[model samples]
Target: MLALTLSLALGTPAQAQDADVHEPSPAERARPDDSVAGSEKLLLTAGVSELEGAAGGGLTPWAVIGGYGTRDQIGASAFYTRVNVPDYHLDGAGALIGFLDRIEFSVAQQRFDTEAVGAALGLGRGFTFRQNIIGLKVKLAGDAVLEQDSWLPQLSVGAQFKKNDRGAVLEAIGAKDDHGIDFYASATKLYLAQSILANVTLRFTRANQIGILGFGGDRNDNYTAQLEGSLAWLLSRNLAIGAEYRMKPDNLGIAGEDDWFDAFIAWAPGKHVSLTLAYADLGNIVIKDRQRGLYASVQIGF
Candidate 1:
């Protein structure tokens, strides 16, 4: 989905030498089980930084907070991601901090390269669109991790403020604005006994191409509701397999947009680092069709 590609790494480690082993800190050595909130959560429960910098699956933000910190501690992480398709490429990087396992703050920037398609649109070859995003999230209720016996899932609400740099170019393509805000609420449940994690998010947005093509459009200038969902299977403590689907709006009359989908593998060899790889179908972008390719990301932090 043009999203997180949250977790899976070909399932198992074929060779231990391929991954660098994380050296434990002195405190962890002295008290393994009581190491603190930084490593207290189950491995991989602190979701990866998503495309937009929120914690969750690759393509969509889940209800889970961004880190392993509990009520009295803090946790943070940084991430880099790249998506390569036939006619375009997207690169993003961000960092997030979680406070008291209840609130999250993040910042990210994205670059979308049109490649040869830029020339077709008379925008020059390799034209690129750059955008910046700031996000905040607050947990509303429940706990996806510790409340396994409860039927309720974790609930959270978030907002993203995005600004695009190429205002003139974006308006030339029928975009109504160069900036917009997105609001979303997510619900997530972790079924440890079943080894499954599921999430659903409802988003209110007006951005086009996640804001690379700018915000709103001539077709519909107001925000619209969209849906995002993720399902993951825990194959092991460090491995997970999942799929994601995210609905998008067809705002630009000239370029018909399609929904996005992906299948991903994520692996976390240690608590400090994780990697994700996915096959993503991005449907069509401005002047290109069938924008399908690889999605890869790396995250590092406590």
Candidate 2:
């Protein structure tokens, strides 16, 4: 769970301040009540960035497009995040641009620090695995923010193209491939009356460690179906509490990878900036068992 915000797309930074003190921009104030394609006077973090660079939760991508623009406008944002486990560290950064509230394009870079495990594996004391990801998403149907009374949810389809830097090391560890593309479809629903947001995503992937450890392994070279989901409660206009569960594949035969989950709290003190804190259970990584620790992220966008 490592995705994170941008508040520079819709209005001035002052407008993003605490929800209680937030001032509506002219565009937002003039928006029609029936607007469903774009956000209207919503908190900047209403659509959190997903790990793969799409809009949603920390692990699962949702249906909503990224950025702060309305249907008639274009919005964009950039983010950086860090996850610290007992024996490992992960750092990621990315930028996303949304068009007409219908399409999204993004690029992300991830670095996986092996720490002591790198020495154990004879790769040095602080060996790292790096990967670059390019992603695209299209809004397929429905509206997550609007149609609250309807049973239908917003839906989208996305793809992530990942390339790892350590091809030789990956192959040495039984990885069948060092790169691959992942496909996924997601649905998200916002229940304003109930102050809850829920999402579910199904993915077809062959990546190990979400592609940080390379794409496929000798043990399983084919793509497998995986699921990710999130449930959140809006405590206030700019505050939310949530839990996420993401299923992962055990492709490498050397060390087993377990599913991931987290309990998180997100706060947007202003429309331009937001922060998220979480306790994540990453199961096991390499030689370390039960890799659990703090996850933190900060974003500034429009």
Give the top-scoring candidate (TM-score). 1
Clash total of candidate 1: 11
Best by lDDT: 1
- Angstrom error of the Cα, residue 289, model 2: value is 1.1
Residues 182-298 of candidate 2: C-alpha lDDT, one tens digit per residue:
999999888889999998989999999899888788679899999999999999988999999999889999868899999999888865677888899999876788999988877
Runs off by more than 4 Å, candidate 2? 1-41, 44-46
Write model 1 residue lDDT over 160-186, tens digit each, in one string: 999999999989989999999999999
User: For model 2, what is the error of residue 90's alpha carbon versus the real structure, in angstroms, after optimal superposition?
Assistant: 0.4
Whole-structure CA lDDT of model 2: 0.83
RMSD of each: 16.0, 13.7
lDDT of 1 at 87: 91
For model 2, give the 10-residue run with minimal summed lDDT: 1-10
